[model samples]
Target chain A: MAVIDIRIDLKKGVADPEGNNTKKTLESLGFKGVTDVKAVKVFEISLDMPAGEAKKCGEDMCVKLLANPVIHNFSVTVR
Target chain B: MKPEEIRVCVLRIEGTNCEDEMADAFRMAGAQAEKVHLKQLTGETFPEMKRNLEDYDILALPGGFAAGDYVRAGAIFAARIKSALGRDVKKFVEDGKPVLGVCNGFQVLVELGLLPALDGTMSPVPTAALYTNDSGRFECRPTVVRNDNGGRCIFTSSVERGKLMMIPSAHAEGRLMSRDLDFIRKLEENDQVVFRYVRDDGGKAEYPWNPNGSESDIAGICNPAGNVMGMMPHPERVVTRFTHPDWTRNCPGGEGDGLQIFRSVVDRLG
Candidate 1:
């Protein structure tokens, strides 16, 4: 199994408006259970390499293309 | 002093990598290299480093994702420098000492208002900018840099004329921007522009080698004092020949791409 994961920040300019809209809609629907929620996504990937080297290769993946780094942060673990 | 006795102290923090590599590079070049953490640069640690900085000839800012790019890359750390190590750095540079910043290190220097040139002297405010790439992407590639402006500076001495160093650059805000043509002209005229991205044939930073589309094809810049240098590329990562990724096909396995950078500093200190 090959698993490659990437995480990206939803900039405040773009993320907050949607989050606020959802809160309003949920409140109208009487689903007030969710509050102060921030949405973030994580991707998990498994590669062909052995576990010992997967973390090392994962870092290489980040260095190459996975993370933009300017606005996002990432962490990787091989299982 | 013997070359082996020469010391290099590398500043470090949580997200900074390449501290080990920096130590290794100096060690490989016959210098005593040590990684000193960021906390040690604080006022509380000032008493210890005041005398220590004089003992170690080279002060290097190794590359990494310092503070995980929180609240802007290098912004917080730059503030720490201003509040913590500001006076020491001021004295360090004013005394004509050598300091280097790579990748994130470059970011920190710019944040500290060190890279910007104003009125032919150091800017009292930030004049240099390293923003996101115009293409909206992080670039990773081998860049060929020309040392057109790196004249007698400690890091550029060993790089021969028309020499091309292949180094990896992994950063989003590597684009360089400034408005002082007088300063730019002075640098170009004085051979102080230091390193610029170029094609593999050493054709100036354009297109592929300068993947980020940095302004004027610039890959690196040194301060007017020539004691402070900052660049976006990762020279520490490419210090070995096999690390070139195509040893059998093209790499000739010579001095490794970044040895000259370290060697030049050692030569200067000695």
Candidate 2:
């Protein structure tokens, strides 16, 4: 069995309100050097297949459901 | 078809809280409205509970945090619909049957690639998205949306062009955005824009008036065929004058502004 990890994030130039709010909170806490904070989602899945096949399957999941291509960018890796 | 004969399927799923009012709105509009679960339509339930999408004259998706709005608002529900009944929905829209999406419902329509289908009857992938509000707050207040479709949208046919209706908006992510730079211009050219947020005096909307800071103050839009319409307002919650926030404060006692939206579609079906 192989495990696959998928990471999704807002595309470049897309607004990330939650991330911005967190950055503001950090600044208020005296972390002044926080230039930016971008948030992301990671999904870990176990597949009863080879690593190569699992990687392909993970990409399909991202395209089909996990990530919305309109405003999201994603990456898949075998673990 | 007679008004009562028009069967409206108010589609809902777990976490969808506005189906009852949506069904009631259709009923008040003289249509036979049914609150149907998505599983029921997909035949995932018992034999007696099975309902088909083609069985109804209209499909209405109401507001609420479907699937708790995880990942993105309406993402799970839209994916489920697309995987389970995408073909049927496509056919339903292609047949000229009306489809209405309000608030979270609008998000689902966009995620399901049913709205802003500029290239075809239904885009293979979503071309647009409803992003987080510019204010970064969940805005819940009475909003005014001006009809701008010029008779292209079936849902707003009863409303005069440039008429503003007071509908309440309540959501955190209702800002419509698209990667296409000419999105607004294309919608205008195709007459797909159905409503635009405006000030009470009919001037350009700003801040709370525009609510979500959508481009061009767009509150709603329709497909090229104008059979599918999606908006980020709760028209169902304001079917009667008594429900209006300022009804007791000199507001006229009559049908609520939102009623005309339902009536427009129901009357057209009749």
Candidate 3:
């Protein structure tokens, strides 16, 4: 069996309102060193298959539903 | 079937809260409509609940979160629909049937690749998205939407060209965006733009007036064939004169501004 992890984030040019607001709050709390902040959604799946197959499944899931290509980009890692 | 005989499917899934009102709007427009659950269509639940997509002349997807909008607003619902009734839906559109998606429903349509199926009846993948609002908050407010279909969209048939109609919008993610650079141009060239958010006085829209800050002030759009449409506003919520945000001022008791949207589809069927 293998474990797969997928991370999804907004596309580079897309405006991330939630991430920006979080950055603002952090700055107000005295975290002035934080120059940038971005948010990503992570999904961890335990697949009852080989690592190669698990990786394929994760990519398919991202393309099919986990990540919206219109405004997001995603990466899948299997271990 | 005649207008009165037209059977409209107000399709829904879990977390979809607007089916009843959507069905009511169709009924008031003189069409025989019912709120059909997605599971019923997929035959996943009761055997008696099973329904066929080809059985209806119109399919309307209403608002509210489906599957709690976990990933993206309508991604789960769209995926479910694609796996279960993709072919039937494609055939229904090919047969010239009308499909309307309002608010969250609009998100589902776009995610399902039904609307802006620019190159074909149904794209192999979604070509656009209803992203998070610019305000980063759920905006539930009344807005004026101007009819801009230019006669290409059957859903806006009763609305005069460039006329503004008051409708209410409620959504946290309703900013329609596309990676396709020519998306807006193609929509314009094909006359697929059905509505544009506008100010009450019919001037250029600003922050709240434009609601979610969609590209080109777009609020609603239709497929090239004009049968499929997706809009961020809830026309069904204002199907009566009393439902208008400012009804108390003029107080002319008649059909609501949004009724024309429902009436147009029925008229097309008629």
Alpha-carbon RMSD of each model? 13.9, 1.1, 1.1
TM-score of each: 0.72, 0.98, 0.98
Which ten-residue region of model 1 chain A has the weakest summed lDDT? A9-18
1 or 2, which is superior by lDDT? 2
| Clashing pairs in model 2, backbone N/Cα/C closer than 3 A | none
What is the TM-score of candidate 3? Answer: 0.98
Give the lowest summed-lDDT range of ten residues in model 3 chain A. A30-39
Candidate order by lDDT, highest to lowest? 2, 3, 1
Q: Indicate the worst ten consecutive residues by lDDT in candidate 3 chain B.
A: B248-257
Chain A TM-score per model, please list them.
Answer: 0.58, 0.95, 0.95
User: Please, what are the lDDT tens digits per residue for candidate 2 over residues B43-122?
Assistant: 89999999989989999999999999987899899999999999999999999999999999999999999899998888
Report clashes for each candidate as comma-separated counts: 9, 0, 0
The segments of candidate 3 whose C-alpha lies over 4 angstroms from its true place after superposition are: B251-253
lDDT of each: 0.70, 0.92, 0.91
TM-score, model 3, chain B versus true chain B: 0.98
Ten-residue region with minimum lDDT total, candidate 2 chain B = B246-255
The model with the greater TM-score, 1 or 3, is 3
